[model samples]
Target chain A: MLGDEAEAEDVLQETFLSAFKSIDSFEGRASLSTWLHRIATNAALMRLRKRQPLSFSVDEVTEPGNGNLIPKVFYDWCCLPESELMTQEVRDEMRAAVENLPDTLRVVFLMRDVEGFSTQETADILDLSLSAVKSRLMRARMALRERLSAYFGGAASADMEGTRYE
Target chain B: MSEKHAHRDCSHLLAGLSAYIDGEAEAALCAEIEQHLAACENCRVVVDTLRRTVLLYREEQPAPLPEGGEAAPVQSVRTG
Candidate 1:
């Protein structure tokens, strides 16, 4: 999501304006909601592209060197109670982790996961291949998983009890 | 198995994991991933945590757009 409220407002306005202008071209191939989402996504991408260039090289943190996606450090948090995992602090961490992702990965993850767009729809919206969207999504998830692990696996663990591993 | 084959297998399964968790993977691939996950504790942990992370985000309420923000009426576009 656009971090600035003002910028988000601008994008929303621009999206409506653009969609309005191009309504004649609305071929009914995609649903109205899908079309509007595509416009919104493109508007966001335009703003993001202006702020930073797309990252073509994958980050080294989750790069599959030996064909293994193994985390440098892994902790099992599967047994943590939902009450603990759903804490406000954890929610904030999730938001921050997502916001920290590179623009390319973040956009795809948002369109695919957050917006509930199908993989094919996301790919078409972002003008990326299906495989590319999948790869970026994987990288984004991996980075977030590692970050959340570091958070919960460290000091946070002290505050919560009954964190068991299988 | 040779090191190369073992690494390839791991890579293959790892690459397909996101799709598997999303219920997008083919049945054959899902079966293979499930089989691998049954035996590989590390992968099981990764998949488990990754799934939870996505779920957490999904459960969040979407931030509301600015107040009184109305879409441009489609009728205007059609009429124009």
Candidate 2:
């Protein structure tokens, strides 16, 4: 999420140190990984806030379908073959698409969709409400869909043999 | 249908789409969205690509785990 390799490593080291110092606070209610994940997320967010505080604020969560995220690119790229979609170039594009998301949406999308966390888990990790998680996730997915559409929109057709998204 | 209920509008249906794909949506809302998708080609493409986008990202390689070390203890990720 920080989008810098050195900074990401710094956050990782910081996460372990924090966990060590606060070991007594480990309630063990959630998995160790989840707890660590939360620490890591907060650490990353802290760095993000330090860099561009105004852009990282989650004070005003946007409502779903509020017109800010209206789908502009309606091309259906899901018909592309798996080999075509999973190419290194496409993967790089995928990573860039995610990296380009706003901080709030990017964090929610990573925890919920990328990490397989339940929406509630994501809310708890981010200190957001369940509804907030849902709305943010909805916006994040739509934004990514638009980005990917630019790449795969006209590359193939639904009639292509061995369609995987069917 | 009431004039106040423009729920069929593409933007309105966009709100419930993630829930619909995630199976977190109520059945009635799901029906409403699917109904809209059948008639709106753009919405159909949006929903399909949205679902696919989520799926694609879900398969992303996991982030690296923190390696354990007993080096000088410092600070945790969060702060006051």
For every candidate in turn, the CA RMSD to the true structure comes to: 5.6, 6.5
How would you encode candidate 1's per-residue C-alpha lDDT over A1-166 as one tens digit per residue? 6677778777777777788789999999988988988898889877877876645344533464522244543567867898888888888888899889877788888877788998889888777788889888887887888788888888556655445541
Local lDDT at A22 for model 2: 97
Model 2 stretches astray by more than 4 angstroms: A63-65, A154-166, B1-8, B63-80
lDDT tens digits, residue span A57-127, model 2: 55547533365567776667787789888888888999999899898889889888878899888988888
> lDDT score, residue B40, model 1?
71
Model 2: lDDT equals 0.79
Candidate 1 at residue A35, lDDT?
Answer: 90
TM-score for every candidate vs. truth?
Answer: 0.80, 0.83
Clashing pairs in 1: none
Model 2 compared with the native: what TM-score?
0.83
lDDT against the true structure, each candidate: 0.76, 0.79
Q: What would the per-residue lDDT of candidate 1 be over residues B1-80, giving only the tens digit for each residue?
A: 22123333466577777888899999999998888877776677778988987887788777676665554333333554
Note the DockQ of each predicted structure: 0.40, 0.44
